[model samples]
Target: MASYGGVAVSGGMPRFSDTLINGGVILEPWAGIRAYASYAEGYTVPDVGRIARAVGTAGVDIDDYVNIEPIVSNNREIGVELKRGPLDASAAYFWSTSKNGSLLVQTAIGAPFEIQRQRVEIEGLELNLSVKTPLPGLTLSTGYAHLIGRTDGSANGIDVVDRDLDGANISPDRLNIAASYVQGSLSARIQTQFFLSRQFERTPNAYPALYRFDGYDTTDISLRYQTGFGALSLSAQNIFDSFYIDYYSQTVRPNDNAHYFAGRGRNFTLSWDYRF
Candidate 1:
């Protein structure tokens, strides 16, 4: 096992600082069962260019811009897995907190510039399971994730509100599922996704602050063929060509007719790969 920590400084800026520590232990108190755990912590300062972009103003002299304090994030995660015969499963949880988190604040002119005083917190849990059945050449795998986010000292001090909706954007819940079948040199896969109902902030002057959207569902399919020399693959996205809007923001001006940017329709791609 090995662990390390160090610090250094260069240029006219402050010295760099970081600390990392990790160790793993394998336990086999019984046959066919295993357990392990590891932990780590690290830190780093922000980039000079990012700092400049966050505080610099348009049409102003670069020399006039001032440097803001560097931001930092602390992250942690832990996971465990179990396996027995053809079945295997694992679960993990992660969380992160930022001091002076960086974010982009939209200007009155409709462009997003950077801001650093904001703070952010994110937490999530994930699980994965897979099984191989007695049936010859058959396998099944599935996974899911749940995430939550919050911001502190926002423009309106509203916690748990969708920051993406600040400009009248809407955030929706998402679900995804996929499966694949394999035989010989050919394989096929199919996937589907669903988005729950969302409400967008309309052009403040023309309509109310919110516009509800009907949820939409979409599916995709793909097939691939492998030869001795190369492999050919093709896929179609949004195969159902379901018409829906992925994102929308309130226009700066209420009377502006072009307030929404439409989402894409059905799309396709094909490619071939060869190895020497």
Candidate 2:
């Protein structure tokens, strides 16, 4: 239930309607654990083609553009779970808060983008694991993720701006490991990924080396073959072809140099699935 604003049809703009209130709850005392909690409501608006090409004022009339509203959010979560036999695990934590939040200030490569309107906060963490390897059908898995954000640029109240939340809008904590196998009909999979390296602590903002994010690692392989009349698949991605430069093309670096891209060296895919 969401309805955003700003529409033009003999209208002056500014409309908002919401009927949100998410929910969650789970419990299992002990016997293998399980616990949870949750709440949510969200919205986002303002990207009308990057605010109509960064509005340079010519015929501006989207209700006079008063910070282009809508950025309402409030989310929370907590989790825990663990299965007994063959092991399986989980953990989750989440947080979000927003009040008019919007930021995309990166002007100076070809300029045109300075939209700061703030009061934002985000936090996240996730962990998962699974194991069931007595070799009968093999399975092993691992996962990890983390995120942090900050912003209090003060549009009305709170002021303690440390800014931070770049890397093209957060994303630089990663780890994943996987292995799976299924005999009969032939199936195989292998995966690996780890991208963790970030640094921040250089006030006086404004493209401080794009907020320093440099970390990379990757591996992937997959194979499948089934008989009678269908299924044949093979996949290989980044198979040790690690070149770096991600996190939103190195901090959304505006223009030129094709936005500095360089990550993609090995790739292969083959598929044929037919069953009719």
**Candidate with maximal TM-score:** 1
Model 1, 1-276: lDDT tens per residue?
Answer: 011112221224444344555555667666656556555444544455545544333343334233344456666677767788887887878776664555544444434444545566666777777777676445666666655555553456644333323333114555656666787998887877776554433222233544455557788879899999899999988998888755443222233345554456789989899977
TM-score computed on alpha carbons, candidate 1 = 0.67
lDDT of 1 at 163: 36
Q: RMSD per prediction, one decimal?
A: 9.4, 19.1
- At residue 158, candidate 1 shows an lDDT of 49
Error of 2 at 114 (Å): 11
Off by over 4 Å in 1: 1-15, 20-38, 42-50, 54-70, 107-109, 133-135, 154-174, 195-216, 247-259
All candidates' lDDT scores?
Answer: 0.57, 0.76
**Model 2 CA lDDT for position 19:** 83
Cα lDDT of candidate 1 equals 0.57
